[model samples]
Target: MPAEKKAYPLRISPAVLEAMQRWADDDLRSVNAQIEYVLREALRKSGRLKPGQAAPVADDQDDST
Candidate 1:
């Protein structure tokens, strides 16, 4: 089963939104999903999310990006 998701309003600059949209397109994910993916990765890297906790989707690209 999938985890439940909540809806929240977000206010972002147009430039940031445009960048996210492009990145999301490159990743073949919806803009919302891409944002969530990025957030999850950041949280995990910063140790806010414990090991074996909710894992973000795997990113196949090299880290050079």
Candidate 2:
């Protein structure tokens, strides 16, 4: 069975939002998905998302958790 989905609000600057939208389109993902992807990658690269850390269950998983 698939995991449950959760929604959370995020606030960002207009410029950042626009950049995310463009990146999402380029990657064939939605704006929300793109943001989560980027954040996950960032965390992983920074060592914050270690192997033991819970993996993102899906593309739309809430990364802020």
Candidate 3:
């Protein structure tokens, strides 16, 4: 089972959105999913994510991206 997600309205510049969309396409993810992925990575790198609790892995996909 997946954890529930909370929804929030975010405001961003068009250029930033465009760049993120392109990056998301490159990573084979939807824009929203890519945003979550980047955010999770940033959180992990900064030690904001709890120790031993990491982002969920995609069973069939390589996580090289």
Candidate 4:
């Protein structure tokens, strides 16, 4: 079973938060989920995450943009 979520209070500037909100909306995810997604990607890119430790991020082969 997956571990339960632990709540952590975050303090972010209004401008940054608003930007994240807009990006979250565009990605069809809630602001909180978008934040998690962004952080996870960063960790993966920096090689901090172990291979196979987390499920993979899907690639879109059909993306034309």
Candidate 5:
């Protein structure tokens, strides 16, 4: 079965949003999926993700720490 989709609310500048939209179209993904894919790649590159592990959730409380 396919995995469930999760919705995340984020604030970004219009320029960034535009860029993401273009990128998403180029990659044949929705804007939301592109963002998730980027985050997953970043986490993996930063050594914060193990092989086959899921991406970590970014909690609102995390900003305060």
Candidate 6:
């Protein structure tokens, strides 16, 4: 069974929201899912989460070039 997800209100700047929207569109994910993916990657990279608890490291793919 999947873990239960909790809902939390997020306050974000319009610019950031717009950027995330664009990225989410490119990745074919909802804005919420994109945000969660980025957050998980950050946590994994920072050693805040165990390797098994988070996704594998994705290849470096910079879209803002």
* C-alpha TM-scores of all predictions: 0.78, 0.72, 0.76, 0.74, 0.73, 0.78
RMSD vs true structure, all candidates: 7.1, 4.4, 5.6, 8.2, 8.5, 7.7
User: Candidate 6 on 1-65: residue-level lDDT in tens?
Assistant: 34456567889999999999999889877777788789998887898977788553232432331
Model 3 stretches astray by more than 4 angstroms: 51-54, 57-65
| Candidate 1: tens digits of C-alpha lDDT, residues 1-65 | 45555667889899998999899889887677788788888888998987768755543432222
- The lDDT of each candidate is 0.73, 0.71, 0.71, 0.69, 0.69, 0.72
Query: Distance (Å) between predicted and true CA of 30, model 3?
Result: 0.6
Tens digits of lDDT, candidate 4, 1-65:
44345467889999999999899789867677777779888888899976666653332321211
What is residue 37's positional error in candidate 3, in angstroms? 0.8
lDDT of 1: 0.73
lDDT of 3: 0.71
**Which candidate leads the pack in lDDT?**
1
State how far residue 19 of model 4 sits from its true place (Å).
0.3
Ten-residue stretch with the least lDDT total in model 3? 56-65
Q: Which of 1 and 5 is the better model by lDDT?
A: 1
Please provide, for model 3 over 1-65, each residue's C-alpha lDDT reduced to its tens digit, 9 standing for 90 to 100. 65556666788899988999899889777667777778888888998997557555442343323
| Residue pairs clashing, model 6 | none
Which pairs of residues have clashing backbones in candidate 5?
A: none
Which residue pairs show backbone clashes in model 2?
none
**Cα lDDT, model 1, residue 28:** 83
Worst 10 residues of 6 by lDDT: 56-65
lDDT of 2 at 11: 83
Q: Give the clash total for candidate 2.
A: 0
Kindly report which residue stretches of model 4 are placed more than 4 angstroms away from their true locations once superposed: 55-65
